[model samples]
Target: MGNMSKELLREYIKEQNFTNANDILNGLKEMFRDVLQEALEAEMDEALGYRKYDGIEKTNNNSRNGYSKKTVKTELGPVQVNIPRDRNGEFEPRIVPKYQ
Candidate 1:
């Protein structure tokens, strides 16, 4: 997946004739999922004050906890995302608010 390029994506779309609205929506959903996941991870890093596997000694009591599955409604459709968590449960995400 890391090796996939825009040209390959375009070729796949053309080969599959993904021109219909449903196909476009599905594609957008997938793209949004990837983006949202990355954002959530980044948010976690910022909240924890360290990157994943940074190997730095813990300076604070709060740390990253496992993620929680959440389904959000969007214009594309219902997209499932993994929301990051903190041990102190104080890491509120600004990208997708907890109540939203």
Candidate 2:
């Protein structure tokens, strides 16, 4: 994929029917949330040395346990995200660190 063209962006705005500044801000916030969430998931994949559900034996015992709800501050404001967990409690998310 390539960068979104201005014409495509304008078409998207028209389709969304953004009525005011608030609508645009909300859309940007949602996009930020999605990007951050995807980054976190990719980090987990790297830490685990395999993609989710790959069925390959993990070199170590660590595996994806589940997710923990965490709120992180961003320029858009505080956005909630599901931080993936490892069974041994070692999957520290670099994007949204625990102390942040």
Best-fitting candidate, scored by lDDT: 2
Off by over 4 Å in 1: 1-21
| lDDT, candidate 2, 1-100, per-residue tens | 1697989888878888998999998888887899899999999999989889998887888899999999888888889999999999988888889777
lDDT of each: 0.87, 0.88
Task: Give the 10-residue window scoring lowest on summed lDDT in candidate 1.
Answer: 10-19
Compared with the true structure, model 1 gives a TM-score of 0.77
Q: Which stretches of candidate 2 lie over 4 Å from their true place?
A: 5-8
Number of backbone-clashing residue pairs for each candidate, in the order shown: 0, 0
Q: Show the colliding residue pairs in model 2.
A: none
The TM-score that candidate 2 achieves is 0.84
Model 2: how far is 17 from its true place, Å? Answer: 2.3
TM-score of each: 0.77, 0.84
